[model samples]
Target: MSALTLAAPAPPASAPPPRQLRWLLRLHRPALYAWTGLVVVLGALLLWLGGPLTDASEAAWKQYNACGMAACTYDQDAILLYKDVARYTGSAVLALPFLVAAWAGASLIGRELETGTAQLAWTQGVTPTRWLVAKLALPAALVTAGTSLLALLHHLAWSAGRGRVDNTEPWYSIETLYAGGPVLVALALAGLAAGALLGLLLRRSLAALIGSALVTGVLWIGTFLTLPHLWPAVTRVSSLRDGPSGSGITVAEGLLTADGDRLAIPRYCGSSIDPACGSLFDRLDAVSFYRDYHPRSHSGPLLLVATGILLAVAVLLTVVAFRVLRHRTADRKGAAV
Candidate 1:
């Protein structure tokens, strides 16, 4: 007869449920580190610009202004230093979206799909929907936080130097317009969505990268062309003798003839205050000079409108990506069955 002794039942396995976020963080540790480093570097640069750099630049500007074209000379190094820092900071901020797009298309999705790793992940208890969600959600949260911080810092730095630095960029300048508000973060999110969609559609790392960059470039160009028209521009009309007043983002400036038609200034008149220019203007019946512009107050509305548009695009792209993934997964399953 066999012995009736039975071994003690083994304790139930105590492992925690699988976490897609942990796996995601583990897989992209290097990217996580790189993003952290970028945020820290940019934050430090903005701090310096707002503090010591601003003080030095403002002081130098004051000295130069006080000199008033006399014997006094300003410090060339100080002037150059501020200009270089401002330019570099603006360029860096502007370049962040393209970097996000490149990484999202090449490494985030395309490489995994290209290598069959994404399919392998699907077989490991991760649904396609969860996989895509994890991928986009993690990066989007990090990017939004980092970019918002940078934008805040940039606004601080720019405000610190305003009115004090003679060469400071205007509020409506391209760099300032994008980096000083929420629009930059919105654009970055849009880039991420576009990259993910391209990666899913292309499934090739190099092609996805190029496609992502092109998409971002097109968005940037479109924004640049359309930004001025986002809000209703203020129009001012003055006699041709007086000219327009109060500087802003000029949409159009032309001569308003007595016949109520707008005509561009003649090329021959070229900033000359001569009698011939006056005669030409009179002959053309140019009674008033009209200027259409976006005032500084309009910046907030324009930015809000632009941000809303970009965010809507991003949401639409993400939805499309999800549908595409679902369709592809269903097709594969059907083929296998």
Candidate 2:
């Protein structure tokens, strides 16, 4: 009897709870490395763009300006190089939002759900809400920090070239403005949210990737169309000889009648410098060419408004994703309990 009692097997040892955050990092280590590498490269390029490249371009522009009416050699290669670098780099910076959306949709959330890893983790001790929060919070922090840094550098680079490099984009140029301000950062955050929502909804990586891209593109285009109207534009009136004239984002431009009524400028009637156009302007009772537009000063207001809207959207999407996820898994959770 003593031997039989001693031979009884010891109770099975209990397993410890899962480490959600650690496991998450291990699963997405590849994406983490890739994102880090990309940020470093872009930061270095932006620094060069704002420093040596800007200086070289400015010098070339000065030389070109000094030539006057005479043919003289200038550093054309330097000018071209600056132009190419600024264009390509700005484009890349602006495209970052879409890239993030694709990755977040395909890899971050969708793949785990598709492969049943997400379910397995839930069964192992990680609650679904906690899991989703971990996924969104960590990536959102990384994306915001990286994108904000790049945007700051891009803005400094463009600012360095402003008024000095003749070929540089104006402050109001859509791509330049978008890349060099808070709008880029906001868009990226929105993209991350959009991708996450799509992933949970579709539960398929490929479909979610495509859907995220399309949704982000639509949001961007809508912003482009709506931006000019977000802030009040200044009105400037110039003589008919100068045509409708003003800089920055043009909201509306036409002719003003003597009674202060706004009228459309005639077709093929650009300038009063042209006798035919001058005659047309006179017959139309055009007092002056009027332009309602935003100057460089309005960029701040526009950006702030746009950024606020995007952030609100991101928050809304995040909340909805959590709700949708919970609703879908509610029955399963109840049964498990």
Candidate 2 deviant stretches above 4 angstroms: 1-18, 334-337
lDDT of 2 by residue, 1-337 (tens): 8999889674322332446557966788888898889999999999999999999999999999999999999999999999898888889889999989988888888988999988887766677887887788878999999999999999999989988899889999876889999989889998999999999999999999998888889889988999999988899999988888888999999999898999988888878899998888888888899999999999999999999998998899889989989998897769879
TM-score of 2: 0.92
Give the candidate number with the greatest lDDT. Answer: 2
Cand. 2 Cα-lDDT: 0.89
Model 1 lDDT, residue 144, Cα: 98
Error of 2 at 148 (Å): 0.4
**What is the per-residue lDDT of model 1 for residues 1-337, given as tens digits with 9 covering 90 to 100?**
2344655554332321367447865788799899989999999999998899889988888888898769787786887898899889988998889989988998898988999989887776677887888789889999999999999999999999889888888998877889879989988998999899999999999999999888988888888888889899999987666666547788888888888999997875633266787888888888877889998899999999989998998899899999999999999999999
Where is model 1 more than 4 Å wrong at Cα? Answer: 1-17, 268-272
TM-score of each: 0.92, 0.92
